[model samples]
Target: MKYIPLRESKKEELEAWLNKSNEILAEMKLETNPKKRRAIIHRNKSHWRNDDLLNYLKKLSDGKCWYTEARFVAEYPQLEHFRPKSCARDEDWKKCHDGYWWLAFDIENYRVSKPMPNVKKGTYFPLREPAMAVCDPDVAITRESPLFLDPVNQGDAELISFNALGQPEPCPEPAVDLCEWDKRRIEFSIKRYGLDNTELCDRRKELWVAIESMISEYATNAKRATHNDCKISKGKAEQLIIQLKKYLEPSQEFTSLISACFLSNKVGKALYPKLLTQLLAA
Candidate 1:
């Protein structure tokens, strides 16, 4: 997943939700009566109906489910409870499902997901503790363990990788056991959320192949031009470099290929300085 910058409008909506959640929590705490608590919960769920909020979140996330990166839209979006209500006992549930009722409106815990992924019927991948600690210090106490990835933390992406097949894989790190929790989480998320299944994987692979072909074509052109005039206009060279850099930024696979190309010094030496200057400016 790529980094998502939060907008001011979203922040305002979150604040409003939080206020409503706090009011519900207060009402729950004041009422010891069971029927009253149930009614309160129902009322709270009603107030939680913010279609605009959900739409904004889904748009911000680029229509991908937070956990599985599967597309979730108008008909498919699932509203997930950051902390499941099931976690709390009956009495505690009446008070507040999770300890941090204050965070009920917190956008950080709120994620746009699909029904299957949120249900955990396919997998139960938990966030990593260290990452959670960085994003939310209170997470460890509430979650008790880390097996899932936190979207809020930018560094969490370093732990995972996507193959040409569009399948998720663990990064080449010695510490995490790929066969155990990490692999299970990936498998579960894929199956549960229907990620990279069937057409999606095929489509992604096709796109990857197309990008590779473009890079190859560029390399060929560069080679042929080098032998002909052995010279290219400075502006033309700069334009090519800019395009390559832009394509590389959003693509992990392309970034790696660019690194390999540069490390092997495959690109013409004359073009190196110009490319370097463009990159530094970027």
Candidate 2:
């Protein structure tokens, strides 16, 4: 997962959807009964399904799932609410309270996701402090600390690390040592987001093998160029660096993992000190 920058300019195309969202919010505010408010939300559920809005959200993640960094192939992608729309579930999957109905149509709350994780997430929006959970639309949601790691937040994305085995885990040495709470949050995100599903793990493993092979070949070429002044070996090493740099592109699938692998590998580290200075800066 990587940080997905929001494009507020795209909101221009959502005027009609926003207006309809306001109408629903108003009705929800007037309804005193929880059941009736849920009914109101169900009736207007289609308002958030705007095609333009979806396209904009997809662009933020380069057509990949924000949480898992999986590009859609066989399955159709979905516009998921970072926070649930109708009902909120706790860490234990217990129904905790009414969802963030006001933000149901808020474009900022949307996340582009794959079908499996989207369905698995369902209404679950666990918080660090349940008591601080916002029940009313008027309350600032910023007060509530969510346990889920948001792909849109660079810090949250950095909390997760992929192992050489292709399993997702908490970063072993984060910039700062993570507290117990933060560690739990990262662990929860890995399991809940389906980051370790079989297919994804296998694909990541394949990538790791490929990267390892290239790094080894680069090391062999670099040594020959340095000791024997071999021009051909120098050219080959330069080309290998170029190929490795492509893996770091933001639009590349599993780029965060690719970056982690390159930065941590012993052979990669040796190359980075000299030839990979500019690539590391990127």
lDDT tens readout by residue for model 1, 33-93: 6566666665666555487777777776667666555455456587665544323322112
For candidate 1, the 10 contiguous residues with the lowest summed lDDT are 89-98
Please, what is the TM-score per model? 0.62, 0.90
Q: How good is model 1 by TM-score?
A: 0.62
Q: What is the lDDT of candidate 2?
A: 0.82
State the lDDT of candidate 2 residue by residue for 19-71, as single tens digits: 87777778878988978877887787776676776777787788888988978
Instruction: Give per-residue lDDT, candidate 1, residue 15.
Output: 72
Top-TM-score candidate index: 2
Give candidate 2's error at residue 71 in angstroms: 0.8
Number of the top-ranking candidate, with lDDT as the measure:
2
